[model samples]
Target: MDGPPPLPLREQKMNSEEKSFLLPKGPSRLPVSGLRLKRPASDENEPPKVDRKRARGPLDPTKRGGPVTAAPCFPKPPPAAPGLRSHRQAAGSRRTVAAAAPKPAAAPAAAGGGEKKRAPWDLKGQVSDLRAKVGIYKEKAQGLAGENEALRQRLNQLEGELKQATARNQQLEGQNSALALELQTCQAQATESLQRVEQLVEQEQQLQETIKSQSQTIRELESAGRKAREAKEDLAAQLEAREAELRLAQESLAQRAQENEALAARKAQLEQKLHESEMERRSLHNAVQELKGNIRVFCRVRPLLSSEKEAQKPGMSHLRFPPDDSKSLVLSKAEESHVGRERKEDIVYEFNFDQVFPPSSSQEEVFEEISLLVQSALDGYHVCIFAYGQTGSGKTYTMEGPDCQDPSTAGMIPRAVQQIFRKAREMEAKGWKYHFTANFLEIYNESLRDLLVLRPERGSELEIRRVSQCTEELHVPNLCYVPVASEHEVLKLLQRAKANRSVAKTNLNERSSRSHSLFQLRIEGHNANRELHTSSVLSLVDLAGSERLDKSLSTGDRLKETQAINSSLSNLGLVITALSNKEAHVPYRNSKLTYLLQNSLGGNSKMLMFVNISPSEENFAESLNSLRFARKVNECVIGTASNRK
Candidate 1:
């Protein structure tokens, strides 16, 4: 009642603010015990009921880290308006009357004992106090009611908002789930894009490598093309050169063909002229041989011998070569026709022949006269050239020569052989071939010995048989016909024949051949172009020396040799006589010499007789006998020569 000492200004201001302010009580105003702070028309001991159905609110920043505290309590609930505040004021007035009842007594007693004094009873003051208190509590209660109402409204609003918020959260969560799925798809796409980028990078590298290899191949192809182009150029150059050479060869071939054609025409013309000339010459040759007689005789005079030179003749020489003609020989005799006659008056003898060789005439000059007859053998005519004279009258020398050393002195046989060889070789170009056979034999005492045989014994049996009687050409059976190719071969054969010839020492001659040596040449030729064959013979004979038995002073074997020689010579003379007379039976069988020459003497053959004569005065008788025989032979005509083909 003495009003609690006047409140502090700060406290008064806080109370006034509490009364005036509408905000609710905070935790700071709550009692420390279990009781809550009081309010107008509200119970103090009952705690303020919180609506547990309310949702939790946001945290308070002011209460951070503070002790746990409940919401502050306030008076009971009232009407939402100020009516609830009047009721609480009436209740507070009743409580004020009851408190005034004890205040007077306690005040007096305390005054007597000097206790605290009581307030003066002023209605305005008491009412003011009580009113003030009620007002404060009423305001507090109102504020509390207002706060509760606000809180309830807020909770209800929060509940509705929270329901809406929860729905929104659910919608947001669903949206988030969809967004996360989309994000995962985006991430996968991004990852895939990265992988693709890596693959692209690898492909680019491979493309780069491919481009590099292609560049290298392009380089190789370019190089090959260059080489091929160079090779083509070289081949083109070679083709051009070969073309030029072919052109040159064609021109040369054309030229050669033209020349050959011209030459062939000229050859044909010359051959025709030659054929006509050969025919004319052959006819003329035949007529000449006919006029001269088939057996033509030639006389050769020997030069002065050594004995004649030692004993010179006092008068003019008996032998003289004619001044008017070379074919005539004149011999003058100082004595009469008979020996030791007084009426000498210089007997004169003149001889004419086909040819007459003078004492000084060379072998060539003599061969020139007889070479034609030798040539007739090659022309297919059987020809005979016989040396018929006494032993020392140069018969062997004229036929075979002194020796073969001097070519100019080579006789008729050697010259004829050389000519035959030359002609045969020349004819080869004209398509003619010749086979030549040579045989040399000697008739000694009517026995034939082959001169060409390698060796001969003293008593060898050599047979000489005649060819068939039906054949005209004389052939000796078993006679060796050695084939000869050259002039030297013929000369060799002649040497062999000479070595084998029968010779003896006689009074009139130191070495006289005691046998008739016959060298036979058989020529068989064919003209390949004409296909005509021809056969002929050339019989070259060197007869033995014709000697008088008394003049030679022979006896014993020498006499027998002389008799045989004389007998063959006499038979040859008889055969000649019979041929000259054109008798039906010419004595060809009378002697071996005549028999051997049967075909050459009287048949279709040309016979040339060389009558060699000595110029020595001591051999006048033998010379006269040879001259007379030559004259007889010159007059004889055996037959017309015919070539055998």
Candidate 2:
């Protein structure tokens, strides 16, 4: 039989494309012998059908003028049969038939002129159509070949995976059985766990109740604590108030006590002044009021010396002070006292003064009495204070004192200078400026010498000149008047002058001052508020101790010093006597001491005398003499003291 007729070019192209599309995209790894044609679903048990449509587009050499291209053939694969061996047999038979179809294509080329001769265009179209089909089939084959290689690898991998899945399924089946048993056990345990959870929830509710109760109790405690703290704060405030009141009361009491003490002291001072006024009117001459300006006399008794204490006779007291009057003192001998034995009074020698200080009185007590006069000097009143006594009678001690270490016993000179400097500072608020000059001099052997200056020799002469008659004040020429600002500087100057003083050891004293030392402080002040200037002089004199020639037992220089001392003291007595007698011509020129003190004694100056005496039986006669002299001084009337403002 002849082969089926060749298909038209368009129909052949459509059939070729259909065959390509229907064929599996991937090729089988097996040879074409293992391939099978697909069977119709309606014919399940029958062999696969021969697909002539796929075989229709064979290469026809007689139909093309040019070189002929062979048509690509694609066999449809059948469904997989139950047995791969029987299916592979059937595929091998079909492969043989397909291989024979291309033989007929070669027969047409050999037919020569007997084949239908196609036109050049028709041949070219058929050839071109065959070429296009060949190209499409080639592209599909290449793609399928690549896909086949990938599919082969995927198939191998899938086979291994399937084996693993099978084993896994078996394992899972076993695991599921075990899991079902575990689930049953877990359900039993979950029931027990739920019961425990229920118990824990109940315990939690009880714990929350306990926390609530504890919180309520804590709140109550906190409220009570707050109240207690407030009460404590109130008590503390009250305690502070009470303590403040007590402190104020204590301060008030102390202030009142101080006021009482001040009042009592003032009363005593007034009483003393009243008594002095009475005495001044009674004994100071008929010109009592006028004589008030005279030098005030105060007598101080020195304590008994050690030697006198040893020599004192038993049952004898030489010094006597009147019980009722502190201004009068009496000296009596033991032999003359007949109060108990003879019923006759003793030869009592009574002397009176402005003030009499006992030996027991302190330096401060003596200073308090003279402090007012020193203040007057700062007030522009010229003041003179002199200490007079026999040897070892404490005249120097009263004026310069024993020591400056103790302020209570520092003596009048230091205390007076200190007061001036202090008052000057205090008065600065009142616009007062003060200038103070200190001049220390001594009258030795009736000659004046600068005690503050350093001398090459003990007997060096010093310059002394009288001021002009027009000037009432006496000025010592070339006197070393040192400027002193503070009490310390004044003390230093006083110490230096004292070291330079003429002193000698005698039978009477260990260190007896042989010359009369005069320490003068002149003050000048300007008051800016009042537009006034003031000038004042404060003279502190330590007279040489008076002594008898026989008692002193002096020969050469000592004798001369004793006579000079006696002469000056006598001149001083005469000046007082003349003033007491109110004479027109007072013998101030009788001695250098008298002449130098003329203004201070009888002129416009405030003068004070301190008669120092020994409270010893052996010196009873000298003590009596000193008291008598002090009596004369007390009675003298100089002139009214004036302020140089």
Give the Å error, residue 6, model 2: 99
Model 2 residue 346 CA deviation in Å? 1.9
Instruction: RMSD for all candidates, in order, please.
Output: 79.4, 65.8
**Residue-wise lDDT of candidate 1 within 368-434, one digit each (tens)?**
6676677678878889898988878888888888854688888788889998899788667445799
The lDDT leader among the candidates is 2
Instruction: Itemize residue pairs with steric clashes in candidate 2.
Output: 37-78, 38-78
lDDT of 2 by residue, 387-436 (tens): 99988998887888885467777888998999899989965634579999
Which stretches of candidate 1 lie above 4 Å from their native place? 1-292, 314-316, 335-344, 454-466
Relative to the true structure, candidate 2 reaches a TM of: 0.53
User: How displaced is residue 69 in candidate 1, in Å?
Assistant: 99
Clashing pairs in 1: none
